[model samples]
Target: MRKILVVGAGQSGLQLALGLQSHGYEVTLMSNRTADEIRSGRVMSTQCMFHTALQHERDLQLNFWESQAPKIEGLGVSVAAPGSWAEGPAARAIDWVGKLDGYAQSVDQRVKMAGWMETFAQRGGQLVIHGAAVSDLDYFSRTYDLVLVSAGKGELVSMFGRDASRSPYGEPQRALAVSYVHGLGPRPEHPDYDAVRCNLVPGVGELFIMPTLTTSGRADILFWEGIPGGPLDVFNGVKDPAEHLSLTLELMERFTPWEYARATKVELTDGGGTLVGRYAPTVRNPVGRLPGGGLVLGVADVVVANDPITGQGSNSASKCAASYLASILERGEKEFDEEWMRGTFDRYWDAAQHVTKWTNAMLAPPPEHILNLIGAAGQLQPAADRFANAFNDPADFENFFYEPGKTAAYLASLS
Candidate 1:
């Protein structure tokens, strides 16, 4: 059997490891934290996986929480009117909900990753619990037929140098904060069905309210993407969970008062339910060279770390794993050479570039045409549904998102 070492038990690493194990490969999965530790730790992400990404998990029979998690039927957008914020209850300039063809769902990574780690072990895959450094990867490279770095945090990331041509930003785009809570009242506009609520505060930033299944059971995630140094960027030093929830609600009241009204009675699900941080959206070279001259291929965020403004982090990771699995299976008895590594990443990039482009575009102020597209969606049901479903397939954005002419043409057709 071909021996493979996957460093990082995240969405990509763990999924790829399990897939390889199913194919009779000798797979060793490394994680910095054990299942127990991960279950008891802080929340990792606001992962709202759409249909295509969710289907990948189902194909692997790894969608354990599918029946338990809430079905997100659509995505709604509410843009705060000019001079509406802080004046009182925020008034919406434009508001509409776009139904997704297939529902999306959010299962807290704390719940998903922990369950997956235990599942990986039960399925006979080797699970190693230790923080992996470059030296560690160098040593593993000697024993395994292939080494892949899926850990996108700490020193492991520095192994892969940034690809300057593909990476457009040098500094963080948004200051991010998140709080998972209970008692978040349902949206009155759509009380019968669940949806991801995206409330735009224009220059200040955005507030995303997503129904989620967490360790504590059914809950909601309140996420903020604040422009750096802006008024919404206030979660930097918050340590107390109560204080974090306090700050999160305070901002909601100030900027997205409509959401604030529903969140007034909510409380954190657990002490680990809050998170805050930021990073530049970047694309890095696929292969990393170790000091010992061994090579490791970077996966997911290690290669393409787009800002969460578009909520594509988890979706991107899932697609990367599925794409890599196919590439590895196709290699047959051939060596896992540098050429093969680049080819694997190139194959994945063919799909990821759409995500990267759309995500990077979202980080900046929406251009006039883009703004017009969003506004017109409010009056056109088909436009709204098409826009909502794009969250599941970002490649569709290439049709009308990047150009004014296309935007005008698409809306005209809808009219």
Candidate 2:
């Protein structure tokens, strides 16, 4: 069996490691924390997995929480005018709902990662509970037939140089804050409660109210994407979970009254259910060189870290793992050299490029054409459905989302 070392036990690393082991490869998965530690640790991300990503997990038999997780059946968008953010939801200029082709779901990373780590061990895959650095990877490269880095944090990720040509932003597009709470009541407009509530405050930032499964049970995840140095960038130095919950409620009252109304009695689901941080959306080279001159392949966020503005981080990671797994399986005893690694990354990039572009566009101020598209969606069911379903396979967005001409034509056809 070919020996493989996967550094990082994230969505991509764990998934890839398990997949390889299923195929009879010798896989060693390294994680900084053990399963118990992960379960008790702070929240990792606001990971809302759409249909395609969830299907990938199901195919690998890794969808353990599928039956328990809350189903997001549709997407509801509300656009507030500039100063009208302080007003009530009645002041919103546009409000609409777009039905997804299939449901999406969010599983808290604390619960998901811990469960996946345990599953990996149960499946006979080796699990190492030690943090790895660049120097560590240099040594690992020589011992393993193939070394794949999937951890997106710390010095290990810095080993992969930024690909400036592919990376458009030099700094973080938004200051992100997320809190998982259980006391949120259903939105008055949709009391049945099965949709992602997206609120866009023009020139300020965006807010997403997502249904998620936490360690305790089902809850709502309130995510704030605040434009840096803007009014909504108010989550600095918030260490207490209760304080964080309070601040989130305050922000909601200031920007999204409809959501605020529902979140009036909200409280953090657990001590580890709140997180605040910022990250520049970046694209790094696929291969990293060690201090000792060994090359290791990069996968998922190690190569592409997009801001969660479009909720694409976990989805992108899932797709990357699936693509890389197929490439590795087809190699069939061939050397996993730099050429093979770059080719594999390129294959994943073909699809990831669209996600990056679409996500970046969502982070920036919308152009007139894009605004028109959103406006049209409010009146047209087909346009709304297409926009909602785009989250599933972002690659299809190139056909009608990026080009103003294509968007106009698509809108016209729906009339």
TM-score of each: 0.99, 0.98
What is the model-wide C-alpha lDDT for candidate 2? 0.89
Itemize residue pairs with steric clashes in candidate 2.
none
Error of 2 at 38 (Å): 0.8
Question: Cα RMSD for candidate 1?
Answer: 0.8
Candidate 1 TM-score, true structure as reference = 0.99
Q: Rate the local accuracy (lDDT) of all candidates.
A: 0.94, 0.89
Per-residue lDDT over 1-415 for candidate 1, one digit per residue giving the tens place of the 0 to 100 score? 9999999999999899988998999999999999999999999999999999999999999999999999999999999986776557678899999999999999999889999999989999899999998889888899999999999999999989999999999999999999999999999989999999999988889999999999989999999999999988999998999998999898888888889989989999999999999999999999999898889999999999999988899999999999999999999999999999999999999999999999899988889999899999999999899999999999999998899999899999988
Off by over 4 Å in 2: 86-90
Worst 10 residues of 1 by lDDT: 82-91
What are the runs in model 1 whose C-alpha is more than 4 Å off?
none
